[model samples]
Target: MEANYVSKTAKSMQLHRRAKQVLPAGVSYFIRYFKPYPFYVDWAKGSKIRDVDGNVYTDYWMGHYTHILGHSPSRIVKAVKEQIEHGTHYGVCHELEIALAEQVVKMVPSAEMVRFSNSGTEAAMYATRLARSYTGKNKIVKFEGGWHGGYDALHLAVKPPFELLESNGITDGALRDTIVAPFNNLQETKKRINDKEIAAVIVEPVIGAGGCIPAEKEFLKGLRELCHEKDAVLIFDEIITGFRLAPGGGQQYYGVIPDITILGKILGGGFPIGGVTGRRDIMERMDPLLYERPKFSFQGGTFTANPATLTAGLEMLRNLEDGRVINNLNRHGRRVYRGLEAVFERKKVDAVVNCVGSLFQVHFTREKVRDVNAAYRADKEKLAKYHSALMDNSVFFLPAKNGAISSAHSEEDLEKLILETERFVGESGY
Candidate 1:
């Protein structure tokens, strides 16, 4: 399989060789690096991406799950193009920012106010500061499998060996007040936070990077109640689940609202963006005029709230506001979940498929995956092989990462995915 991939991706291989001289690991992001080097995309449209080698594959990664409307949707492209002619970056306040923020407040149940940033990592960092400022506490609690971006306070305990630091540069003091708890197990989570001076409890409604496992509805309800009892802010890091789950995001879909919501990916309409939105009282801490320097939790960036990004974002939100597109995508997600499970079951493969709305990941294990530990215990090598097999057959999955379903994906595309999975199962001894 590796030899076959190398043969077909000669152009990509050559590009990778050149890239290694400039970019570390031949990729900008480490996650983009896969075995036998990753393919460099020449262009993408709708549900497919054409690599430099001219091999077109149905893309399930969807630009880190950002392109919910699929690549370069005509409406967003037109809006951005029109905005670009006016100005790309103002570095100052603009009506487009106000329009997008108002739209977010209208759609998100808890979003009484909104703030924007360039990426989810920046939003996570700012949100953490706001929570600490609002509550006057330093301690933050996060779930083991939850991923709230690369912010130091919430970056630990993301994967197995939960006690180890996720990265090297993080200082001990940076994580001193951050507590790690078990995901989906409210009792265990409560025990970890017992009687602590907590500022906030952050979580990913559906764990994305750690594993595509959905938090139990009951567990989320428990967290909401627990946060109230402890006077801690409840933040839902909805970077992966925000617009993709529903127009109102995971909070609306699960009927459990958080005090603050962190959003990214689909919110940008394929552009780079991150947002922090929630109750007005909590969000207002970022306002310098309302509070002095000591009380203020500052949040701003040079590229934040730029015209071009807001133009694209507003259009995307407007399309998803009615929930028709999101509902259809959810329906497709359910179908894919069932189809994939049936394929594995028919082949007597001991695999578990974890799915929530439009996001899904296949774990090569008999154990039911409820948390990150169970996910990592599965056959990692087998999962990689499965993803590679899918890629070879013109289906892309980013190799063991979660796969997303977009509105642009057709019935034929889904059918092809299932048939390819069946073929992979039949051919492989696993």
Candidate 2:
């Protein structure tokens, strides 16, 4: 075991050192980097990923929660391959784009008209702009710890120290119109919305990056009512929850519809994509035909609704239409949640597992984690140690991030994960 660890460490360190010469912090994305460098995956199939050192792990990250069907599924791969043979891009409108848009409109409750973007950040940014245009208001109300994307407008208040900006280079003026509210606290959110200038209330059905804390049903209903009362667009940032919670995303699962919906992640079928859909009248403000009008909200992208991504996403949605995959993944997630809870109970570890649908997170605190602040208060050191130990046992989960269950995970994979988790609990002296 020691020899294997040394070998893995050697390969990862060598690659990380080479990466640092060109890439900042030796990684492309911030979350991909961690202490002692992150594992370099050679390839992944189904629920397993092999590192450069040839060590295999049962993967739970699932491409940052995007791979609901698992890594490099045959359906998506075949579609992409066929699409590439024809041509990857044409610089013109295609039939697949319309087909994909129709599927989204049919599935999502709020989707009457759909506009596509290349990433969740672009979709969310455009959603906010559409809301402002529709309401003729400037301020947007966002919950603390609810991450929309990396855009300047909605990037505030994603984590603790809520008063400060999440990233540098964001001016105070950029955040001047962004109002932060406490998640799950309907009263506090209502108070913040009292300002008549608020244009929208954007929230995550489940806090994905902040923590896998599901929003209360009552809270979501309250926001829907308040947005209608205030004439503000309520945007459900379902980038993480879309197609994972149900066929119509969070709105269908919770029976509370938002005025505007932001979707990405799973919709891409392991590719890059984002979509903004909402009421026809509101979405019409982005119509290129209305370019001469003052209310027009400009939204365009070079790679928006590309045929390759559309073909892959369409195939994924077709597979999900039967709902068996969704049910299986959610069941697997519940099993893991219950198993983890039992381990913590028997081991006397002061921990709580927050789960909703196929997403779950382990917090090293006894308190129920309903919001970002509660999650932040959990023991970070203990959680990291547990994650690292799990990694050592050939079980891979995103360190300090949530875990996602995919249809690719077989019963054997789940059983092994539970057994390994139990072993970690027994050996970890925390």
Specify the highest-TM-score model's number: 1
Tens digit of per-residue lDDT, candidate 1, span 365-406: 999999999999999999999999999999999987999999
Instruction: Give the TM-scores of the predictions, in the order they appear.
Output: 0.99, 0.97
Residue 137 displacement in candidate 2 (angstroms): 0.6
Note the Cα lDDT for every prediction shown: 0.92, 0.88
Give the true-structure RMSD of model 2.
1.4
How many clashing residue pairs appear in each of the predictions shown?
A: 0, 0
Model 1: how far is 327 from its true place, Å?
A: 0.8
lDDT of 2: 0.88
Q: Which ten residues in a row have the lowest lDDT in candidate 2?
A: 1-10
- Per-residue CA lDDT of model 2 for 183-294, tens digit only, reads 9999988777675578999999999888899999999999998888888899999999999988788898899999999999989888899999999989998986865568
